[model samples]
Target: MGSLGSRIQGSSRGAEEASEGSCAGTGHGCDCRKRKRSSPCQCDSEAEEEDSLLNTPRRKKLKSTSKYIYQTLFLNGENSDIQICALGQEWNLHKVYLCQSGYFSSMFSGSWKESSMTTIELEIPDQNIDTEALQVAFGSLYRDDVLIKPSRVISILAAACMLQLDGLIQQCGETMKETISVKTVCSYYSSAGMYGLDSVTKKCLEWLLNNLMTHQNVELMKELGVAVMEQLVQSSDLFVMQVEMDVYTALKKWMFLQLCPSWNGPIKQLLNDADSWICKRRTELGEEEAFLSTEQGAPFTPVFRQVRLQYIINDLASARILERDNILPHDWLSAVYKLQWFAMLRTEHDNDTGPQEANKEEFDLNSMRCGRKLAKDGDYCWRWTGFNFGFDLLVTYTNRFIVFKRNTLSQPCGGSVSLQPRRHIAYRLRLASFDSSGKLVCSRSTGYQLLTLEKDQEYVVMNLDSRLLAFPLYVCCNFLYTSPASGRRADAPEPESSAHSVS
Candidate 1:
């Protein structure tokens, strides 16, 4: 009834020793074997035969002993020698298993009075340690596989870190990484940072930058530290697919959430006085320095500095930001707008292959290299402000090309590229930019195929051919109905929609 060897033996030997507990030693009983007689009923041989059976193999003995130790430590908790108090509950643990930990080893190994006591009480005086986490952590020292729930994972990680259980710490880290997501990553990051879980921290930080803390998922951005938020703004690698203002808008919302609880005034008024709002900090910043203090804009100044005002923020967003008075002042806003204009120019110059001589005759996109200046339909904001000049050029197949001065807007910092609604249905489009003197600047087209427009659907097309489209830019989409599927003439142009200049 012990191991595989004990359960299955010589059939005749099993039958002989099957009478509750009998003797079977080398086919000869111990006493009779010494007397050179085959007597089966020698009662003294039971102890010798049992010892021979149980202690034959070193590995089996070790495995058996290990199992016994585990059972004695965990299964027989009532007989435990130590009472560990955690989270208002006392746990029974064996002194041997407890000694395996440096924390408990230091307590029980010394000549301390508690070491020799019959009922030693153990406690870790950490207010933040989770009791449930401690229980699970202790259970792991006995059982190889322990279930760490998401709700308790952070707590368990903190406890394991405090106890200096390296293996359990590693397991808890893997559990955290496995469960890392938008919903749980913030807590995981907090716990990892709090407990110095470096591997988990690195992974979670990567996740925060790549997938979680973005315009599409702004909620996670609130969980970020000011340092991390600043790093995000400073990083050229940080990619948010939406317009830059969406990113700013998210910060605005987070700012509001920090202040709305205390003030009894209008939200507009609060936004106007955002620097005056006070908020609480989640954790200690470190020695002597408070996490949050009573000061104007102390909580949010770090946030505002990293807003990347150089990105294209549209008129609406600019107005909203100016109205809030939390982020930018009038003079600063105007300066930022000018700065953004120069930044866009620099980006455009960098993106250009070469300042090619103004060529209106060369219209083939494939013949030229991929860049904003060459590729058709590439991401270029329709700079209505600077796009006041351009003339229409007539093309083939009953079609015409309305090439605006400057084929497309330079790199965008803000706003959607939606044309003002007017009375017109577009059939075909060829959006391009030309210089002030009616010279072609850059061009993007649907490439030989006329595209129909749909309402509210972002018909964004990036040429695998045009690599410059990788950067986020607004492409001008005109309204037109062309039904080639209905056998209607694709070139039949509808009424053109009236639009004003917007960038």
Candidate 2:
């Protein structure tokens, strides 16, 4: 039994690795998947180890001579014992392969009525379970290991679930994880959700969130159902390429695609009762093709509700985004600004002057402490970056979107410090950590030059590799301008693990 298990394992891997050879002989090019490999050698190296060679030339010759598709003989039925049918196709499967799965073991064992039957008909009539995938599964039981490919993963998953094939399920999950990318994300997410695979679903969601900026296709966004969209938007841990405004625009584009099919393909007569007030107004201004589309728009409101509109500082861009074809109600942004004002006022009163209508710009860090002073290590600096516990900031591998939520951090410095550059150089900051071998590694940014420390400002890190540093790192920023004679190392606190995996 042990040697058989090892041989089956080796064969499964060998079959997957020999993709070109596998297709050359039998199977692959699933009608249910992306179809034929661009190159069979295009398979990833993560698949499996090489099979051990037979000890003697005699054994090798025998193995090669016997390399017939013996399973096909069962389908051909010289004297087949069992008839298994699925999706209008019949397979003459041997009991050994079929019995390996719990779903089949229960059925074919003496305890079940199927023990008395030779014909087994699967009830998965709703899904197109690829016969090719089933062939691989059964073939593994005989002489090959399971061959899992990303293109055929969804079909394989559906078939495996119904067959209760645990090995196929695991291989599908691992392959999905290894192969996830911009193009396959949506399809993979759908498949993972359909099969109730939580681990794969989590990886998909995280990858999607961190890489959302890569895929901005309206059709792709539309394909993502409301539940998935909401899940992406609702997470604070979502790593985006820009501010929430980019996220907002992406969401609006999706809603537009859903509400206005004409946005993509071609214009059509708008339903008279559709958001007609907005449409008729658009028509009067020679903007007949432009207006708010409310079709299926209700489900998307929660996504916009989660957008931090107040955090988007570019008033003009925000206005243009909100006014594009009048797709969103004009009053929506009005209400948003009002809420921003209300929240700011409430927080301001709670923090200091006890609730008075002050201009939003009045709260700028520049207004506090006259704002143009150098960031010194004295009482003026709020430790480093003026953030408490550093929860309001994160840096990614690209350093293109280093999110430092100014307002989200505790205001230890009370108001903004000088973020603009002095001459040509920008304000700089550094974070450091002891490596696994106890060496200090540092990540610094000089990109804050010519920038204002506004509550809703966006900043990018200038360094590439520095941002990819490990977690449990510490932040350090101090100026030791004491008279050179005052010889003493600047006292610094240890960095807490932010776990900001830079890569």
Candidate 3:
């Protein structure tokens, strides 16, 4: 009986040992084999087995919801509920998606005839809209986003405007503003005006104001219409090089191009060709009258009239050009000459120390525009040549700082200089640099402001960062030396030059 009991005890011990070994291997106190089939096992072998189940060949991801809808409903026209025809093209569309457009929404929601019709024919009166533009516009209703090429943005904008797609219209405006260049500025300006895109129009004007002189282009000059040219020339913001005379010269070249559109010549030869053309015309007509008074040149008179004749006649060389060109009416030159004579008398006799107040209107109409170009970074000191009503302003660039010096006795200057203790002048200064494509890379401006300067005193107009300083930098300025006289100095003596003295 003792041997049997010992054997039973040994058997019991073996069974318990085997159970412990199984539990240790499974990492669970309970037997994994006895657990439900769906239960988790904490063994490494089970983890490996589960990992094997997950391993499979890679596959392309499913397209997004918006993309799938655009392809099936827009591209394939599958199960389309509506058809839109415009610009001789048809688009299979759905009412639910088309409702996103205000035009279609109104048609579907209102009692319009299109609401009951399965196919609607749209009347696109806008010439800018085309078949491709219609396709993109219709597809945009179904897609999350649309890709607009800069070249095609105007067309899309027209389509969007007709369909009352405000979102797409805004996008097109932003694109036009971003892509404004010499190539696109004129067209964009015209289109913006036609489409009521005031922001885009203003942007184009600002670009032209900055680049018209700084980055002169022959093609661009040819594209400018008379109205646009007049607007630019009359604006005080026009970037003029050297003096107001240069503005007149630029206009002359532009007018020549406008008349002779087929004359595709390099810019360097443009001026001579223009002069010869005018001379030949004058000879052919056998008319000694001013060119602006003639029928052929009459169209350009408005643009030419914007030239500040007072400033042009101040310089002897510029005056000579004015007489030689015979472009202005004799009455125009006479009036300006008489006006300048009285102003000069005030400067010489009346102790008229420059303008004290801003006088924005006077400044805008008569300010002297001048500029310089720096091909490379270096010290530059110069003065624009002309009698500035005794306000001899000297401009200098050094150490990336632009300094304006009111010259009284520091330098030997040909023009007269003001001697008043404190002479006040209204002026604006602009600086800019461009990249290879004539894109403005860096720019700075000091809007019109009144500045007081003493004799030999210098003021820092601008302090530029070295990093932002670019070669071929352009500096433009507008200066109003004296206020508009309330009335001609009552007893002012006549100047040596007569009213008819221009010739």
Question: Best candidate per TM-score, number?
Answer: 3
* Cα lDDT of model 3 by residue, 1-503, tens digit: 57998999999998887754454555455566576546655674676776787895668766778888988889999998889888678888899988888988999999888899999998888999999999888888887689899899889988988888888989889999989999999999999998889999999998898889878899999999999989999999887887888888899899899999999878999999999998887777665688888888899988988889889898998899888788888889888888887787666666566787768888888888889999999999999988888888889999989999998986565445667677878999988888765678888898888988988899999899898878889999999887666554533564545222100
TM-score of every model versus the real structure? 0.48, 0.52, 0.83
Candidate number that wins on TM-score, 1 or 2: 2
Candidate 1 local lDDT, 67-122, one digit each (tens): 66567777568578777765577777887877767666776779888788756544
Highest lDDT against the true fold, candidate: 3
Residue runs of model 3 more than 4 Å from their true location after superposition: 1-62, 410-415, 487-503
lDDT of 2 by residue, 1-503 (tens): 57998999999988776653443332434232234555333223222222223332342344542245454554444456778887677877767667887778888876777787899887675364778877666555555456677788888887777778888788888888877766677788888888888888888886665445433454565577777788877654344333455566566556655655555432132222233534455566553233333444456666666664545522456556456545555566677566445433322232211112222222221111101111222222122222111122322322323333234334446343222111011133344443332233444434223233343344554443534655544332211100111122212211334111110
Candidates ranked by TM-score, best first?
A: 3, 2, 1
Worst 10 residues of 1 by lDDT: 387-396
Lowest summed lDDT across 10 adjacent residues in model 3 is found at 494-503
Comparing 1 and 2 on lDDT, the stronger one = 2
